[model samples]
Target: MRHLLVRLATVLAGVTVLAAPTAASVNLDVAGFGPAHHALAGHGVGYNINGYNWGGYAATGSGFTSVSATWTTPSATCNSRSDLYAPWVGLDGYGSSSVEQTGVATDCSSGRAVNEPWYEMYPAAPVYLSTSSYPVAAGNVIHASVTYAGGSSFTLTLTNQSRGWTYTTTKSLSGARRSSAEVIIESPPGRYPNFGTISFTGSTVNGSSLSSFNPVALDPSNGVYEAHTGALSGGNFSITYQHE
Candidate 1:
């Protein structure tokens, strides 16, 4: 499950792919960090590196200490196939191996969208918050953050503003790179659902606007389902579902 999402690092006019060959492999998430943003069409710097399994913005550099964002939990129009979706914030996994992240998960496994709050220190399976405790529902305002404390210890926090509840935890990941930060809407590594637009505001890295970091936009183009990313303004953006 770790390296399974490493698809399409680069795309050419004729369909080319490149993978981010680094610590990113050991960290399981929706999309592998890959290279940078290049498209198969015009503005082709090298290879197109958007539209993997995630859509939004990723700020790549090094020593990125923290990342946080607030978004509305999207109401998912579920399918019978049990598709899933999530909107979250994290650190690393852009060009590094590990991701320390937290957010809300919407699963359609039961013919209805079931929403829950969760967190993950990659290489480790995600831990969902107690459903009966940290309840999440569509349209609820959610704020999540991942901060690198120091020396392999990091903190993850998820809050449901509408519910007035917050869950915070700190864990250790010895190999984490702390190299990148991102805010994204992604499918959980399998099928997808018709999650409407996810509007993210107050997105930041190190207490500054995420857009100021020159974040690269991702399209969540998996050749099946594709999502669109709205332009970033004051660290605010939206990810919308297009088609499957």
Candidate 2:
């Protein structure tokens, strides 16, 4: 099970975006959840996989210095317990235990849809960046990027292009392997969040389009689960729900 520390607020107008640190961690242990889990993990297009379904590309060695992508938020469905899903791009999380990622979470909680923007550096919890000024919602076109600023420091930026809002943050983290860069869609730990469908476009690594390289699909072994639930086309990646 993955544990999350969420910070959130509802906003309406002009908001000042600030760089802040929130702590959260995901335990990518699929065996603990039993055999029926539907999470899929994929890598390529500069992406990495774990217990969740992911789309993106990863460099061959020592990871990548930066990764970026533009995506449209997907409308999701929920079960009685309300599932959780997030779309993000970041450095690390491929061959290493550390991941620095930021993006939006669209959830079906209590039968209602909840959306929020957030950032996280692994070994810490995720911080929600929703203020009275910068709010995110479904169908928003978002551009997100993560860059290594040398050493243990990194910067993360998110732009809600549809609403003309943006958030940026920089932080220092220790023990990051810097092994891979990724764009991913993930289900936390409780119920599998039925993140309807998410598409990532214009994905790049080290400033080049993902189409310039040979990208691979994530295998089910990486997830310890049975579903290989994503696909890649040109420079885009799409994620779908798992079927029983």
lDDT of 2 at 95: 50
lDDT of each: 0.71, 0.59
lDDT of 1 at 159: 88
The best candidate by TM-score is 1
TM-scores, all candidates, are 0.81, 0.72
Residue 242's lDDT in candidate 2 = 50
Off by over 4 Å in 2: 1-60, 219-231
TM-score of structure candidate 1: 0.81
lDDT of 2 by residue, 3-23 (tens): 332211111012121111221
Residue lDDT tens for model 1, 1-244: 1132322111111233333344234333344323223334321232124646567889988889999999988778865433666788999877665778888877664568888687877656677778888888888999999998988899999989999999999999898877789998766333457886889999999999998999987776555435778889978988877764
Where does candidate 1 stray beyond 4 Å? Answer: 1-49
RMSD of every candidate to native, in Å, equals 6.4, 9.2
